[model samples]
Structures are given as C-alpha cells and as structure tokens.
Target: MPHSVHTRSDTVQPRPAAAASRGRWTYRLGRWLGIDVYVHATFLALLAFFGLRAGLSGGAGAGLEQVAWMVALFGSVVLHEYGHALAARSFGIGTQDITLYPIGGVARLNAMPRSPGAELIVAAAGPLVNMALAFVFALGHTLSADAGQGAFNAAGELAWPLQFAVMNLGLGIFNLVPAFPMDGGRILRALLATLGNRVRATVWAARVGRVLALGFVVAGLFGNPMLMLLGAFVWFGAGAEAGAAVREEQLLGASVQQAMSRRFLTLSPWTQLGELAQRELDMTLLEDGVFPVESGGAVVGIVTAEALRDGLHDLGPKGYVADVMTRDILCVRPSDELSGTLRALHGRTLAAAPVVMAGRLVGMLTPRGVAAFMGGPQLRHA
Candidate 1:
C-alpha cells in the first residue's frame, strides 16, 4: 500500500498548549516518509547547547560540523521510531503519530500487537534500523583506510563522522539492554510471552526491568547522571506496564455488568428539589447531582449543578427536580465489555453514564467507579 494512504485514527486529543511548548524546540508535521511525525520543542535546546559547546571547545568550523552531525543523529532516531510504526501498520494496527521527545522518539501505536511474535518484530525493528545505519558508517570507515582512526575516537575532539558513527552504534547497543521503556525490554516481554501467558510474561519482564533500572540508577549516582534519568524512566515505565497488564487481565472476560456501580442514587421527575437534596443527592458522598430519572417514556439526561442552582431561584425550594433536569440520556448496555465501555466514555462527553439492561437502568458507571474497579485489590480472573 502507498505510505501516504496509511489510515489514521483519533486516539487522544492533542493539548495545543503542550504541543506549542513542544513545537518550539522541534519540528511538527504530518507525513514524513508517508508516516505522521512530531518533534518535541526540546530537541532545539539539545542541538543549540551541543552546537555551542562544540564551537566554544573547538572552533566555528568544528561547531557547525558537530551541529550537522547532531541533526543526523536525531534523524536516525526518527527512522527508528518509523520502523516500529511501519511494522505495526503491516499488522493492521494504526499509529497515532511519532513524537520526538528530548530523551528519544515515541511511536504511539493505537494498541499493542496481540501476538507475541508480531510484538517482537515491532520492538526489534527500531534497534535494527539503528544497526543498519551503524553498519553503513562502519563499512564506509573500513573501506576508506585513508580516514584516520581519530575520526572514530570518542575521547578526542568533536568530529562529525566519528560522533555520528558512535551515536548510532551506541543507540543500537543501548536499546538492546533489557529494561522497561527500551526495545530490549519489549523484546524480553515478547519472548517470555511465547513461553507463558501475556500477564505472567509482563510481570516477569517488568521485574527484570525494575532490577536493571535500579542498577543504572546506582551507576549514574556514582558517575553518570544521564544513566540515572534513563533508569528512572525504565522504573516507572515498567510499573505502568505492569498495572496495565493487571487491568487487561481483569477485562479479559468481564463485561460492564461485572463492574458497574449498583444501588446508585436517582432523582425522580416532579420530585421536590429540597427533597432530592435531602434524600438521594445528599445521601451519596458524591458532590455531583443525582441522575435525573425520565418520565412519560422520555430519556433522562444529566443536569448540571448550575441548572439546579438556577431552578432554585425561579421555582423556590418546593420546585420539582423535573423543572431543571436534562432529558437527553446516553447510556450503555450491561453486556458491553469494559474496554468498549471505556472507549465509549472517551468518545462521549458525558462525565457519568447509566448502565441499562432489558429496558431498565441497572447501574451507574462513573469515572470514579471505573477507577475504583481498576485500582481495587480484588483481581477479576478468567
């Protein structure tokens, strides 16, 4: 298929202010090599600092060359991310977009590959891209014996060819380390997944990642701060991945009925506002008003706090809940899977939704309820 024809889906809304802040330091565009890409704002600062350092330490000539090399280095990072995106695309998974952060590039795939083998390929493709670049540079260096070894030396003064080769090689090698948020860690998870269940594999891989991350932290505190930051990234990434794995396990065979909140408070149409405030609304610990119950076969919609406050002014304390209640209800059936329900929540602007079954409201599924279900100690198993 033509790369430009690749399909895109709305995974999440972009925060304009956040994107603006990020754009100041990096490039932002759609369709680079037929893939959407974004470069964060910090990449500029990184380039500027290194460029100035090279200039001050060497000369204008050296600085300009080094800056060019730095750009190429990040360019390689972009290619690495694309490797993953493209691999995922081949499997019919969609890539939201690739964002180049200060640390590295991130290709936000809509969902992880369901198969372990596919995941291994997607994860390995990135580091493989770096390896290819490194091989090309190495071959060039070897074929041209006239080129001095000084150009390849990391300890020596900044040189474009040497820095480029070293960065590419290092990136390829570093990403192979089995740590969370790194390609190696993903490779580990995929391999383990083939031998066991995904959740178990995730748990094992995450544990290994945490241990490796700690090793990096200790090493960084003694000498390299960069290693420390990378360690922290790995640590948190592993924890988050583990938690997601846990949630996935719970959602595997369960539906909305299993998790939705029962015994929810509801306000009857024509009920006095004062009575609602005293009975249904006040009893529930939530600050939000009760779900307005529909009458005369009408759908019930949510009424905001402002609507109730306004009703008080016009209808007095004796006025009914129906006077200010909204009537456009959007709800989901109890049989729907939790993941599908979560997706619906994102697609809709509703803060809370009623769960219905057999033409009757069975429960409420609010943001708090979902969070509680995900965070609860009891693990729902298949």
Candidate 2:
C-alpha cells in the first residue's frame, strides 16, 4: 500500500520557499515513468541494523543473505506503490514522487481521486499487485519442488524463494485489514461514500481504524514491536485523515477571493534591503511577513521578511530585493475554491501565494488570512 499519512508530498512545514521540493534527508534513486524515486536515509540505517544483527547471530554470509532479503522485500514494496501510481494515472491523477522509508514506500498522488469508484480502484490496486506477486512466487516454488528441487535444504529451513512467497502473501493480507491509512481502509471509505457524504464516510473509516489500532497495540503487548509501531502509525494516521476531512468540509464552497488579503505591501524588485528596513522602522506596514515584488504593474516574485533580514546581514544594505525573492512563485486564481487551494499549498514552503486573474495580481493568500476567513460567518455557514 502507498503509505500516504504524513508523506513528504503533504507534510507542510514553515521554511524557505526557495528550498528544493525533495526531502532534505533523502537520496534520489532516479526517476521511473516520470515519477522521482527517493530513499530516506533511515532506510539505509534499517538495512545496516538488520544486517549487523544477522551477522552477530549467524555469520557474514547469513548477514549478506538477510540484507538481500530486505532489499527484495522493499523492491516488492516499490512495485506495490507503483501499482497505486499506475491505477491513479488511469483516473487522471498524477503521482508526484515515490519515497522509500523504513516503514514502507509512499507514492504521493497529486490529488485524491474525485470519485469514490475511482478511489476504490486506486486503493485496491496496491494489494492486488502484492497478491499477484505472491501467486507468482508460490508458483515458482511449486515448480521447483515438482522438479525435485526441494524448498528446504539439509538444514530443513525454507529456501529464500519460499520465504519471499510467504512474505508477499502476508503483506497482501495484512494490507487488506480494513483500517485507515491502509489500502483496505480507503476501500472501506470509498464503499461508505457511495451511501452519501464523503466526510461522514471518512469519519466512520477513522473510527474503525482507531479500534483496529487498539487491537494491534494489545496484540503487540504480547511481544511484537512491529505491531506496536504499526498500531501507533494507524492511530495517528486515522486522526489526521478525519481532521483533514472536517477542514475540507468547512472550506467547501469558499473561494480564494473571500479569504485573500487585498490590501498589502508590494516591493519593487530593485529596492535595497537596507532601505526597506529603514522604511519598516519609519511607517506601519502590513503585518504579514510576505511582500509581493511588483514591476511594470506585474507581480514578479515574493520576498519574506526573514529573507529580507538575512539579506541585510549577509549582503550589507546594498543587496537588491530581487536577490532574496523567490521567483518560482505558486499562484492561485481568485475564483479557485479555497479547499482546493489549500490542498495545492499543503506541502509548499511558501508563506503566501499571489492571487492572480487574467495575468493581473489581485491579492495575496496567507495562512493568517485563511484563519481569519475560517472564523468568519461565511465559513461558519459553510
């Protein structure tokens, strides 16, 4: 299953907008089918830890073998994520990237499928891949056994192929345990959505996931550390999903114009940072940290207060605003739905986005603006 909870694609953080979109700690493993693949640093640590543990218990060969198995297992996980990505593609949803973590692989879809039927198909695709892999492995084992090549050697331990087959089978079944954050949980939500109200369906699915999480925690208490970790992940993931659903419902029917800041400061790209600081002390300016850089009646880029301050310290007072501004701006239309805008801004590091219409900048949208709008009567009615 594509582990979507808190994945890099949707995990928002306050930082410099100029920073690269990729996770800082992850290493690129190249792109496949236009989707960038990354491996988290912790995944390497996991491999090292397991290999060392196996080496301590058995020998160098055993350690190498264990490492190989781990690689194969995660390879299967990558394929599982690809299954989800390909299925979503059929529904016109693009996957941003796939990242491998210690827990699993995550395929960050650009957006959730708009229809419940499409969602169901996308969610089920991951587990179906695992099931297919398991079947192939099982068949391979059976064929080998029929040819007198037993699945076990003189040590009576199952061969790696047989073990891999069993592992894939377990993976497929476990992911189908109808709980939130899992493919099965999404399947359950999609089914419930058919009864009306996607928000209500998410709530019910979250409730079921939390109950199952408690069960996993209880089962882990008997001696399974992995089960405990999985339980915690499910519990938190369910809560996050439920909360997001509620927020989306609240923002429904609202547009960017309703919440955007119409009155704000705009700086010329050629303005010196030192001069800007002096002006800041001389007059009362917009309290929002972001300033749109405008030139020739067109918004060019954005400069944050933090960036300006840093520029003054690093480049003395002579540094131009253009040097500190982020040129690759994320702009939204005033007529765009607030809910969808928020989704687009979710993982972006920008403090605000320029609201543009017909090639003209009309206003700016910031977190503070959104918060104020959320507390207003319009959102209450929504």
Candidate 3:
C-alpha cells in the first residue's frame, strides 16, 4: 500500500538554507499542473530488488512483468500525492514539490490549511483518489472478466487489473488507519481541532498513532517486514508532528522582539567582500552569519557568511557586497508573532531575516536565535 506525507513549508531547521533547498538523492521526473515531481534514487533500487527476487523465483519475463506492475503502482502513488497538492491548491495553498520515495510519496505544501474544515478536505483528498482509482480498476476487472477473461493469467498469477484494483483498495483503506502523519490522523486532528486547541488535538492524535504503530510492529514480528518499516515511519513521523505542533504553539505565545538579536553587525553595500570576510574572521564568536546591508540610512539587503566567502573566491576579493547580497529579503516587524514570522522565513527558505520597524533595522532573527530563545528559562518554564 502507498501512503502520502505532507510537509509544511514553515518547518525550517537549523541548517544552511541553500543546503535545505537542494533536492538531494532525488531525480527530477518533471512537472505537472505547476507542481514539480521527483523520484528518490532509492525507489529505483527498490524496483531492482523486487525484480531480482521475482526473477530468481520465476523467470526474466516474470521479473519484467513485476517491474511493470510496480511502476504502474507507483504511478498511482504519484496521482495520490497530486490529489493532495490539487486539494491544497483549492485552499490557496501552493505545493513546493512531490517526491516519491521507497516508502511512499510526499507532497510538500507551502502551508497547511488553518481552518479545520479546509484541513479535513485536504487530508481526505489523497485517499479519495485511491478509492476512486480502486473503483475504476475494479470496473475494468469486472469488464475483463465478463469478456471471458480469467482473474488469473496464464502464469497462474492474479491478473494485472485485479491486482491493481486490490492494491488501490488496500491503499485507500490502509491509509485511513487514523495514524498520525497519515491522512486519517490528519482527519482526526482536523475533527479534534474543531473542539479545542490544535496543539492538544495533535497531541491526542500522536498518542493514538504511536499506539497503532506499536501494534503494527508487534504484528510484523509474525511476518511482513513492510509492516515493520511502516510502523517505524508512523512512530517517528507522529513524534515529529507532535513536537512541531508544540514548538509552533510556543512560538505563537512569543513575539519577535523577545527572540530576535538586538545587537548585530550591519554592512554597507559598497563594502568589499574581502573586507567582510576579514571582519567575519575577527568576529568568529558571532553566532549569526547574516548581516543586513544598510544604504542611505535604510536596510537595502542582506548577505550571509557563505555568500561572503563565495564572493571573495569567485570575484577575487574585490567584489562589492551589493554584488553578492540578496536584495529580495524577508523582513519581519518587531511586533509580529514569532511563529508566523518564522514560517514566512522558512517559506522563503531564508537562513535569517532582518527585524525592521519604522524603516529602521532593529534586530535580526535566525533559526539559531529562535532555538536559543525557545530553550531559555522563560519559555522553558512556560
């Protein structure tokens, strides 16, 4: 059975934004309906592994047939993810990309719908697609059977159409297991969110998911290694979802002013990359790598230590900071909620953003700074 994972765009970790943006270990398949699709390298290995196993048991023809079936199944998986992306699009949310992995597919949405109803619709879309596919495949199987075709092929295996139909049906039902990070879990969370705070809902959903995951693991001990893998995915995914929900809740209770760095270095647009690099070396203790560029008494852009190093090496140390600085910068207000502002920064995949008020740069905010604040005594006690 195939499953879909939804990733929120705002969940940025303490890593280089450039590194975070790169699609590592995945090959671009192409784009459809303004959404890019990628297949992980491991997916191919999975196909090869299955093909080899089938070949050893049967023959080359069986191996080829199995590979074709797997491809078709994953094609259905892709459509499953598209179901999620298109549904989110209807809610005015954009998808970053859809990547197919050995386990299943993931649709990275710019943001999850805030409304419970909207979230319920988005979460249910994928399984609905699978169920719809199952119906179509079942109809095809019925038609083929009525036309004097056997359910099993000459190879004594189930007909491809029947297999597809059963697989889609299983996919639809398995994903509705109400496990956190799964469609059913999201549906449960959405329904629970209607009654109270979303964080509490998420916590409840995660607890249920963990229990189900443990059941899966125990059942897998009898047979089915795939079930074991799925159990692990559910276990870890639920924990992550619960943790993120709590972190988001904590951020919502704080303001940018409480977490932002009040003391930070600023640079002139005319500053040479060489000079900036030397200053960066001197300020080795500085935790923040981003520096706002001020020109004519206004913040113009921002540059990172990575950019400074690259500029020095590429432009021979004489390149102006303006040449390398990013002009399209995300700026947050001092009064803005840290949660929302952090989401904006992560949506843009920015490493850091400047805190501006009254057209003046008051401070800087980075994921690291936010982590420090989140770990501080004030939030710790709360």
Candidate 4:
C-alpha cells in the first residue's frame, strides 16, 4: 500500500503499443457476489435467430417457448461461469467480469491461480455446475412426466426440463474438450505445471490444444462453421496463452525502474485545450500524443490526444487540460516488479502510467517502453 515517487532522471522514452476494448458493447445483465454479468451483442443475435426459426416452424407460441428454453440454456451458461468465478474467488483470485457469448459464458478472472491445486478446483467447478444443472433438470423432467409432460408438449415443442437437461449435459461435455481458454486446457496446464516449469507447461498444453483444434478444423471442413470458428479461436488463444506465460517469465527478474520512460512530456492543469490541440497537429514529438498532467510539480492525472480533440470540438480550444484529463488513475512505484506493473496496466485504456514516489512525480511507464526493454537491448548496455 506504500507509494513511491518517480523522478525525471529515471525517464525512458516510450514505444508504440496496440489497444482494444470489448466491454463497451456488452449489456449488463446483473451483478451478484460482487461480480457483474454481461451479455455480448452477438448473444442477442443468436436469440433472435433461434426465436425466428422456431416461429417459422411452430408459430408465436412455439417461438416464445423456444426463446424460454434458450434463456434457460444461457442461464445455465451463466451459472457455469459463476462456478468458475466462485471457485477462483475461494483462491483469492477476483474475476473482472462474466460475459455471456453465443457459444458459452466466459468468466474473466483478474488473474489466474498459479497453484496447481487451486487451478484444478477452479477449472473443474465450471463443468460440475453444468453436471449439477443437468441432474436437476433431468430430475424435474422425470418428476413432472405425468403432470407437466416431459418430452412433447401439445404444440410438439420439446418440454423445458428435458431440453435443459440435455443442453446442460452437452455444455458440460463440450467444455471438457482440451482447448485453450477452456476449462480442460487450464486443467491440463495446471497438471503439467505441477510436473515442470509453468511456462514450459503452457507451451506443452498449447501444443496439445493446437493439435486438438486441428481435428476440429478437419471435421469442420465438411461443415460446422461454429466448430471451425471455435477451433480457430482455440488455436490462437493457446498461442497467446503460451506467449503470455513466456513473457511473464522473461519479465520476472526486471523492475519498473529499469524500463520506465523518464523523458515523457507533461501537461499543466492550467493548460488550455488550445495547447493540446496545437500539439496534436504535430504529434511527432509525443508518444501517442498524450502527457501526464502535473500541478504544483506533482502528477495529478493524464491528458490524452482523444480527450484533447473532443475538448476542442465541444468546448473550443479554451477548455482547460484538467477538464479533459482522467484523474484518480492508478500509479506505480519505481521499486515495483515489471510483471506486477504490467498486471496493473491490464484492461486499462491509457497505456501510459505515471510513476510516483514519496508523493513526487518521478517518471512515466509505457507499454512501448516495456516492450522495447523485453525485445531490444538493455538501456545501460546499449
């Protein structure tokens, strides 16, 4: 909880970095157990397609009923993700958010449990939730056979309980397939990590996953676009996971002070949008045309290029930099390890981080600087 100050003498110029956001398009379904649930845009399209197809086949009533079943399926998917979230929580790993996609639910954990035993529990919990749901639904269908009708309704639509049971079973089985970003692959990684290096374990697991994905792609060659897409996702996801594992290992011995940029520009809180607008016109001198906002020689916040442009349009060039700056941003210490620093920057919009120590502005850390250090020569050696 202690803070560190960043100084100008430690500055290192930043490099280029890529960025993207997915949470923006998601619709919040609800929050529980201190976690938010989101349904992705594509999920709604899936529901619309299923409902329309059912309407064409059976009518409005059938469409509504089919929609209900689909809802139950997604509800089960949400439950499955919750299983992972809760289990990860038990290990002190917080989830970022849970997002439901057309294929299934994804529990985005803030960080994965490095302990093999902890990971095993988290990975297995998801499949177990589906199995439990399958059991409950199967029991309901059996008990309601005489009263509510199990298999066929008067409209010939498959009844809810039985349908849900089968769907849950399928979900459980499908997720157990060994592929990256899936439970089975995580399970595999954990098991292998128990026997050897974590990075090496990830590489082996990724290889297995890519091989498994190839089989799916082969099967998809005949048809099954969904499976083909899933296979492609698995292949790429596995490669990414492997790369992340290796990257983490490489940065383990490095510290933030070793790579943070000390030569970056700063903006004054009193600086008007006109200054930033002018700077934006010739951005060759600034990385990403963004600068940390300093007030009274202390880093207060950051002013980004986009904010400056927007301010210029809305408030004209007279808008103060403070008006467009993002305040209350997370700061890093000079002594912090590079890996922890990178984790702090995860899912953040602004890739630049201000380093502070003893309540004084020190230097700025940027993803480009980190990347350069990792991929290029060491500063002192160079």
What is candidate 4's CA lDDT for residue 124? 84
lDDT of each residue in 226-338, candidate 4, tens digit only: 77877887887777677766665778888889878787777788988887666655565443545789988778898667677788799988889888888967788999987
TM-score of model 1 vs. true structure: 0.79
What ranges in model 1 sit over 4 Å off? Answer: 1-30, 140-163, 268-280, 287-293, 303-330, 349-351, 376-382
Residues 1-382, candidate 2, lDDT per residue (tens digit)?
Answer: 2265222223123433311554567888888888887898999999999999999899999899899999998888888889889999898888877888887888878667858999999988988888899889878878767567687867998876778888888778888898887888999999999998999999999999999999989998997877888899899888877766666666789999998989877889999988988876423333446788999988899987778888899999999999999997788999998877776676565567899999888898876678767653222110
For model 4, the local distance difference test gives 0.74
Candidate 1: RMSD to truth: 6.2
Over 1-382, each residue of candidate 1 has an lDDT whose tens digit, in order, gives: 0011112121112123434433454566668656678876676787889899999999999899788877787788888888888888889887767777767777777677869999899888888888888888766766764746545456666455555677888888888888854788889999999996999989999999999989999999999788888888889778777777767776677787777778776656777877655654452344543363756644466565556767877888898777787665567888888766666665554556678777677887665566567665422210
Model 4: number of clashes? 14
Using lDDT, give the best candidate's number: 3
RMSD of each: 6.2, 5.4, 4.9, 8.6
lDDT of each: 0.70, 0.79, 0.81, 0.74
Let me know the TM-score candidate 3 reaches against the reference structure. 0.79
Q: State every prediction's TM-score relative to the real structure.
A: 0.79, 0.76, 0.79, 0.72
Better of 2 and 3 by TM-score: 3
